[model samples]
Every structure is written in structure tokens, then in C-alpha cells.
Target: MYKNIKVIAFDADDTLWVNETYFRDAEHQFAKLLSQYETENKIDQELFKKEIENLKLYGYGIKGFILSMIECALELSNYNINQKIISKILDIGKEMLEKPIELLPEIDDVLEGLQHRYKLIVATKGDLLDQERKLEKSNLLHYFHHIEVMSDKKPTDYLKLIQHLDINPSEFLMIGNSLKSDILPLLEIGASAIHVPFHTTWAHEKISEKEQEAADYRTVSNIKEVMGLF
Candidate 1:
């Protein structure tokens, strides 16, 4: 199936490592921290709304998320939030940044099995420095040809990546957890994708069923299945 595939771009967060789990944990902690001001449900909704509203300005990453949380806290508390709580919010982000890199099961095996035959690269959206730090710590850096820290993942962005790799759409394949970011965009650009879903997905990455209609791709329950595909 991959006879024509020259480059396989893997999504970094959630796809290669344990990422969304940390974000979920952070959000839960955040809601608890602000419990005095609002219900946990309300806090979660507002924080999500705030993050979406700030995405254009801040892009995607823990840094932007921290800012959104602070903004949400200030507004939710009518700017009456305790100064100590504000400091705690910053500490939350710092702790997230320092979280250890836990590679998803079989990620190394899949990469090792495929790297020799195809160009492997990380095509993902997030803070460049943080992603680099994660990759360096992952010890899987040596398997990839390069890493592309994208601002967003859309058809145009995938086209740009394919162009950069000097490969035709058919020669490129993307594998990731988010169907919205990884699968749909590749299909739209006439490329291929394989969905390897992580246990958790960020709300922003979810797609409606109507949006999934007629998209051609393969999905595997785990990353190990990838090794068998080739």
C-alpha cells in the first residue's frame, strides 16, 4: 500500500507520545483551582472558549493555554482572583512544561521498522522549543529526517509540507491521532493518512460525523498496527 510513499509525517503530540493526557490532567487541576469562583463544568467551558478565541493571537501550545487560563480566571473571578492563585496558575504551566516524555507504546518499533525505507518527519502544531525538548528527550530523534512545527494543520499547511519534502501528494502520508488535524487535511490535499487514536482528544480536534463523510483512510487501534501495515 505504501509502495509510492516517500515520506511519512507523524504527528508529535498524542500520536508519538502521551500528550493529551497531560492537558486533560492540567484542565482538571485548573478547574479545581478555580472551584470557589465557578462550577467545574462552567470553568471548563469558558476555558475552552477562551482558548479558541486566543488561538489566532497566541497559536497553539502550553504557553498560549496558560495565557487563556489566566484570562479565564481573571474574568471568571471578575478580576478579583487572589494573587496567590494567579501564581499557582503559572506554576501549573511550568509543571506541564517539565512533564516527562512518555512515548506511546510501539512508537519506536514503528519508526524503526519504517525509517530505513521512507523519510520520517514530525508534522505537528505546537510550541517549537517545547516540541524540540520533547523530541530530544524522546531519544527517538535520530530516526526522523526533520521536524516541522506547523502553526496549524489544514490542507494548505499539508500542501506546504509536501512541497517542502519535494514529494507529490501521493508520495506523502500522515499518521496522527486527531482526525481533524491529521487525516482530513491530508485527504483534502490528495495525500494519504492513517489514524492512530490516542485515548483522549482535545475538544478542539473533534469533528462532526458529517465532516467525516467519504474520507478515505485507515485506522488502527494502536501504533503497533503501523508496523504490520508496511
Candidate 2:
């Protein structure tokens, strides 16, 4: 469908692989740790809610995630937990960092199918090291012509990437999970975008209003269906 498209950019986290699963697991573990000092009710749902709120204020990446962990730990513990408890939470974050990288099913086939026809690029926002580690470990690094790991996913970031590639916005298409980060910004700049919703997504990655109206935007059930759009 998009045979004329010259560049296809993809978001890296939940779009390509399993990211929200790890964060959800970490939050559960975090709640377990908080239960010792606070009531289960107070620390249960509210803890995750606060963390999600923090993500919006601080943005996504390891630094913000770690900060949210710390904040939730302190809030649930009521400022009484010892350093060891805090250390354990931080250790959980580190453990998440070390976990193996994996991709969604049929991702390889889709990439392989598109590689011959379009310039593939990974344009995502997150910690530089963590994102690079993920790409390197996934063994999918070689498929992309360029990899953009930014602190934020804004229209400017998309503009910058397209400018760097010397490609027209009309010739590019972005496929991703987050409407906030991936679709809206690219659509704002006149690039086409495909939304592939993940089963679990960080709260900060939710879609915005303008993104919902872009004519070039399309939604697919999964990564495999994305190839059909093009």
C-alpha cells in the first residue's frame, strides 16, 4: 500500500519488543516491598498511579523510572524504611536493565520483508545506554539504516531525524505503539504513522488529541498486520 514510501521508522520499546511487561513486574515487586510499612490498600493501586503520574512529569527513560521507584518507595514506606530497603528497590531496577532483550512475534519477518523496499530506521526515546543495549542484544541492529535514541519524542525530534536523513516527510512512515510519542509528532510534520497498540503500555505513552485527527494515521492489530498497510 505504501510502495512509494522511501523510509520506514519504528519505535523501539513496546512497539518492537516487550518493555511494559518488565516495568509492570518491577512495579509489583515494588509494591511487595512497600507492603511491610503501609497498608496493602494504600500502596497497591495508588503506588502505580503515582508512578505513572511521575512518568509524565519526568518523562520516560532509566533516570525517570529510577526516580519513580525511589519516590514510590519513599511514599509507601512513610519515610521509615531503612537504606537496605531502598537498596533493594534500586537493585530491582538494575536487574531489569540486565534482563534479556526480546522482540514481538513475526517482527523479523516484517522487517525482512520491508528492508528490500524501504530504508528502515529506529526512532525511539529513552536512555541511550539501555536502548543501545536492547538493540545490540536483539540482533536486529543490523536491519536499521539509522537509530535515534532521544530523551523526548516530539515533532522536533522527528523533524531532526528526517532532516538528518535528508528524506522528505511525505516519503517517510513511522510505525509505533505510543500515539503520544510516535504518531502525533510524526503526523504533525506531515509524515504518515501506523499505530500498533501494545497489550501493556506506560501511562506516559498515551495518545493526544491532534494525533487522533491526522488523515495519514492508521492503526493495526499487531506488528504482523503492519506489513499489510504498506
Clashes by residue pair, model 2: 1-230
Instruction: Report the C-alpha lDDT of model 1 over 20-111, residue by residue, as the tens digit.
Output: 88888899999999999999999999999999999999999999999999999999999999999999999999999999999888888899
- Note the Cα lDDT for every prediction shown: 0.93, 0.82
- The local distance difference test score of model 1 is 0.93
Top of the candidates by TM-score: 1
Q: For model 1, give the 10-residue run with minimal summed lDDT.
A: 208-217
User: Top lDDT: which candidate number?
Assistant: 1
